[model samples]
Target: MSVWDELVGQEPVVQTLQRAVEDAASMTHAWLFTGPPGSGRSNAALSFAAALQCEEGGCGHCRSCTTARAGSHPDITVIRTDGLSIGTDVAREYVRKAALRPALGRRQVLVVEDADRLTDQAANALLKAVEEPSAYTVWMLCAPAMEDVIVTIRSRCRPVLLRTPSAEAIAGLLVERDGVEPELAGAMAAASQGHIGRARGLARDPQARERRRRILALPAGLGTLGDCLAAAQSIHEEAGERSAAIADAADERELDDLKQSWGVEERGRRPTGYAGSLSSLEKDQKRRRTRLTRDAIDGVLLDLLSFCRDVVVAQQAPRAALVNADVAESVRSAAGVWTVESTVARIDAIVEARESLTANAAPLLVLERMMMEFLPR
Candidate 1:
């Protein structure tokens, strides 16, 4: 029920944050929390903010804890970005707000969920506030890594780095916190590869687990060039579907706003310029969709690589559970078919796929090449 309870598999972080809140020895007005996706970087920052602002130092049952966790607290301001980047204009507004006195709590706390997305101007705008924040202001920025934030801003902030927790730790949280069955929680935790969010999703959604099942089954099918192409196509299709699902709601809202601007009702017919503008908008949406799909596929590729790594680890170090424990049989079969050197090469291919996608190479091209490279000699 406490805000700390929601942060699964982060006991060390929780302890540190609690100590800081208890002793009032938290350094620097600004804080940077870095962790991989699903590691709860933003969640930790906000929880720490709540704890700091709470008169009782994060009394789990207090009004401050409840409001802070629900994102309705007066003294805590959280900014989450849906767009590609957070520009300078918004950064300045946050900085100005940080200078103000607390409205309800001991400190005015600001949490930026995607500080890495801050543009150059945005980083600069934030620099001054971080350098000389108000006595009552506490700023927390969350990102994937410390290097992603500007060094100038980073140097001025206290840093919190979260490691990926073990499967046992993640499973324990799911059972104790979410009231999930112990066995099912362990399975999902194993499959999540230390990502608490993905573990929860796989635990809650049978379909997501099924998707992972289908994907893990793919290595057995990559027997020919045609099969590799088919595999690549399936990945592309799935990613497209995932991205379209994300973009559909936002796209509809944008179209509605355009109609309102043109003084037209929802069902009203539009004129020539409207159609042309819509076409351009659709084109932009398509590009964004493609980008998202490619990103999703790249994530899959990374997971696949993790499976291979687990196989290597299992053979070389049998004490550890495979990173792809969900695909243990598949990994065993793969390990049988290939030598350790070949498995390493395949991992290299996965890295190449990631690089290609990030560098804006065509998705199909990168995946196709990766599949070919992964094929047994």
Candidate 2:
């Protein structure tokens, strides 16, 4: 077995890192791994960190490799966020950790999984750490694109870009790793458009598959203005429910932890400044909820866009395979009715709505505009 086994369809990236592990001259103190969603950027970073610590250069069975991959390695620090941003405090804390020597491994490795979420102050704090690192320390930053990272930080790191894996590769992984039936695995791979996480989700979760079916049905149902508004409201409500499902329990637990830390009981008298701390925690939770909500809405937009792409393909090439092949009937119907230009315009509108959501635009309004524009012309 190899440490790179799980990193499917990224041979070029594997080769680059392997050479660095073998030859010191090819190694760099800082590395950047950039890829689209589900391209396995963080997995690559973790694998590289494991290889650097391994005596046999990432023998998959070694303790070092297993520990690193499981995120239990003493010398590896993974900086990821569930909140909206990584602030200066977190950045500085990791920087201080990064200065220490390897506890038991060959090198100290710090992997920043969401480099794009770093605020300006946080980025500045990291610049010095990446610019002049300890001889035995390495920094790996992962982001969606090279440009997503701040210029000053990325400039100091070696670049490795990962591409979307092919449907064949994704399907093979699903079958081999998760024991998904081969036929369902192939279908989920195509549906996910090389998004490995999404492919697995669709394969393992019947509800996710059902939710996708409903989202794909939207274009066909948008025949009137009321339909459009209703669709937008439905999408917004679903986003709220889904985000709340993920956040509600965690929010309550966090509040409980905070209260306990302040020595305040559920029905006890208030402690001094407890209100301020509670307010801060609530604000953070709200920000996280907002991020989760937008993420949920964006997933809907992406599904719609994928359906639009299939429509474009169907119109352009009548015999081509669609990404959403499970809904071939709908794809063909839409393709037969809508002109290529009209379909393309709606694709543009959905993409714009995704961007608007990322920019903190109102979800209902952005989605309403998007749904309205998607009406058949």
Candidate 3:
């Protein structure tokens, strides 16, 4: 299995990068990889990095390829952040590392997996490094869309766009790579609506599948105001739970690091600046928790949008293959109840909710407003 094999449904991108790897002249010093969530933008960037380091151009069995893929290569540095923003300090550190010569590989590779999350200061710091990179250095930045990156930074890098894989392609990969049964794989692919990671999760985890099922069932259950409010509360609670789980471990780790930095024991005298440091850490934790909560809620909104989209499609073209095909009957029923305009309105409501969440609106309140919009008159 070569490195390219893991990048499902990106044959054209693979070919282009493979050519670049074989011909150094075709390779650029900086690259921007843009794709939707679960479309493997980061995977593509990392695969290219591995190929650049490998003597045989990403031969999966090679030592360089294995180490790069495992994220242990001496000359490869990947930055991924769990927080809301990547600060100037981290970006400067990456820039400093990028100036060094390769320790083991032929070229040093720097990858930023969440370039979209870089603060303005951080982006500026990175921009300088990208503008005048070392001869043997390469930078790869991945984001959800080209527009997510600053225009100045984006214009300097070669852009690689990855499309969402087709359902057939996603299902095939699930069967081939993950050993999922074909029947289950197809269902998951349809449910995931071209998200490869989401399909894999749904296929492998019964809990994930059940959660999706409940979410998908929501559209058909908004028959009354009471039902709509109940649905909203349920989704809000689910988002809270998911966000807490995602942030709790990271929060604990940050607290531990702060404690170690202050040389403070469980019941010891407080050191100088300890209170200030603890306050700063708490502020960062709060920001992270808020961001995680919004992200979790946004995921639920996207799923709701997909379901609404299927209803609109069913209304317009009754014979079309729906994304949520398992719920075809419910979708058809929804199409009957909601005119095309109303279905579109529901989608708009979901988008508005997402925007509100990004604006730091209360999550439960935003969800409640959206659910009320879904209620029948």
- For model 1, the stretches where C-alpha displacement exceeds 4 angstroms are 254-291, 314-319
Q: Which regions of candidate 3 fall more than 4 Å away from where they truly are?
A: none
TM-scores, all candidates, are: 0.88, 0.95, 0.95
Clashes of each: 0, 0, 0
C-alpha RMSD for every candidate: 3.4, 1.7, 1.7
Tens-digit lDDT track of model 2 for 296-319: 999899899999999999999878
Candidate 1 global TM-score: 0.88
**Global lDDT of each candidate:** 0.83, 0.94, 0.89
Clashing residue pairs for model 1: none
Q: Model 1 over residues 1-377: C-alpha lDDT tens digits?
A: 66687777688888888888877565567889999887889889988988887778877789888888788999999987655678788899988899889888889999999999899999999999989988888889999999999999999988999888888989998898778889889988987878898888888888988888787777777889999998998898888889889988878888788777767766777765887777866776666676678768976896788777976886678777676776778887877787888888888999988988878898988888888876767
Over 1-377, each residue of candidate 3 has an lDDT whose tens digit, in order, gives 88898788899999999999998788899999999988999899999999998888998999998998888999989998877889998999999999999998999899999999999999999998999899999999999999999998999999999998888999999999999999999988988877898899989999988888788888777888888888888988887788899889988988998899889999999998999989977887888888777777787888889889999899888888888887788888888998888889989999999998888888888888999888874
Tell me model 3's lDDT, rounded to 2 decimals: 0.89
TM-score of structure candidate 2: 0.95
State how far residue 39 of model 3 sits from its true place (Å): 1.6
